[model samples]
Target: MTDLLLPLAFLANGLAAGVLVGTVLGVVPFYMTLAADSYVRAHAFAVGRYDPFQPACLLVTFAADVAVAVTAPTTAVRVLCAAAGLAAVSVVAISLTRNVPMNRWIRAQDPDTLPAGWDMDAFRRRWARWNSRRTAVAVLALVLNAAAAVALP
Candidate 1:
C-alpha cells in the first residue's frame, strides 16, 4: 500500500504543481497585461474548466501524502511526506480563501464593462499575489514528495 501510494502521491503532486506554476508564470502574467474588458473575457474563459480537475488532483495528492506519511518505512520519509501534506493543505486553503473568490467575481463580470469602481489594476495585482502564493506551496509540496520518494527504503 505504501509503495503504491508514494508513486500516486508524486504523480498527483506533479500535475497540481505543473498547472499552478504555469498559471503563476504564464497565465496570470498574460492576464495582467490585458485591458480590463479583455481581462474579463479571458478570465471568464480560462477559469471554469479547472473546476473539478485541479481540485480533484489536489485532493488526491493530499490523501496520498497523508497515507504515505503514516505508512512510510523511515523517519525521514515520514517527516518529508508529512511536510508535503502540510504544503498541499496550504495550497488548497490559500486557493479557496484567496484566489477562488476573486475568480468568482471576475467570472461574473461583463466583458463590455467592469463593475462601478472596479479597480482592475488592483484586482490583477492581488490575484497575482494569491496565485504566486498557491503556486509556491504547490511546488514545495511536489519537491517534498520527490524527496520523500527518494528517501523511501
Candidate 2:
C-alpha cells in the first residue's frame, strides 16, 4: 500500500506543479499581453474551464499523502508525507479563499465591457499577486511531495 501510495502522491504533486507553474509562467503572461476586455473574456473562458482541475489535483495530492503517511514503514517518511499534505492543504485553502473568489468576481463581470468605475489595472495587479502566491505555495508543495517520495523506502 505504501509503495503504491508513494508513487501516486508523486504523480499528483507533479501534475499540480506542472499546472500551477504553467499558469504562472504561461497563461498569466499571455493574459497580461491582452487588452482589458480581451483579458476579461479570455480569462473568463479559460478560468471557467480550468478551475475544476485545481481542486482535483489538490484532492489527489492530499489523499495520496495521507495514505503514504499512514502506511509508510518509517517515521521519517511519515513525517515527510505529513508535511507534504500540510503544504497541499495550504494550497487548497489559498485557492478557495483568494483565487477562486477573484476568478468568480472576474467571471461575473461583462467581459465585453467594463463595469462602471471598475479599475482594470488594479484588478490585474491583485490577480497577479494572488496567482504568484498560489504558484509559490504549489511549487513548495510539489518539492516537499517529491522529497517525501524519495524518502520512502
Candidate 3:
C-alpha cells in the first residue's frame, strides 16, 4: 500500500487537476461567455434572466479543485494546485469587479431598464486578459503535477 500510495495519489491528483482546469476553461467559461454573448446579442434582453449552467459548472470546478488538492502526492503539488485555484479565483474577481458591473450596466441601460449599445470588444478584451492569466497558471500547475507523477513511481 505504501508503494502504491505515491503513484495513486499522483494519478488522482493529476486527473482531478486536469478535470478542474478543463471544466473551468472548457465548460463553465464557455457557457457563461456564450450566455453573456447571447444576452448582449438580443439587445440585453435575456429570456431566462439567469443562466443555470454557470453555477453547475462552477460547482464541478470547485469540487475538482478540492479533489486534486486533497489527493496530491506532496506538499509542493498541493501548494501548486492551490495557487492555480487562486488564479482562477482572480478571474472570478475580475468578473465580479469589472465584467459583472458592465453586465449590470448593460441590463440597466438596454431597451428601457437597460440600453442596447453593448459592443463585445471591451468585454472580450477584459475576459480574455483574465482568462489567459488563469490558463497560464493552470498549465503550470498541470506541468508541475506531471513532474510529480513521474517522480513518484
Highest TM-score among the candidates is held by which one?
1
* Top of the candidates by lDDT: 1
lDDT of 2 by residue, 30-143 (tens): 988888889888889989766888778888988988888888898888988888888888888888898899899888888767788888778878888888887787788788
lDDT tens per residue, model 3, 55-124: 2333343344455556766676556545544444453455457545655665554333323555555665
Model 1, range 33-100, lDDT digits (tens) per residue? 89889999888888887655677788888999899889889999899989998998888899899989
lDDT of predicted model 2 = 0.83
Q: Regarding lDDT, does 2 or 3 come out ahead?
A: 2
How does model 2 score by TM-score?
A: 0.94
TM-score, one value per model: 0.96, 0.94, 0.44
Give the distance in Å from residue 69's predicted Cα in candidate 1 to where it truly belongs: 1.0
Q: For candidate 1, give the lDDT.
A: 0.87
Name the better of 1 and 3 by lDDT: 1
Backbone clashes for every candidate come to 0, 0, 8
RMSD of 2: 1.2
Cα lDDT computed for each candidate against the true fold? 0.87, 0.83, 0.47
Which parts of model 3 have CA positions greater than 4 angstroms off? Answer: 1-52, 112-153
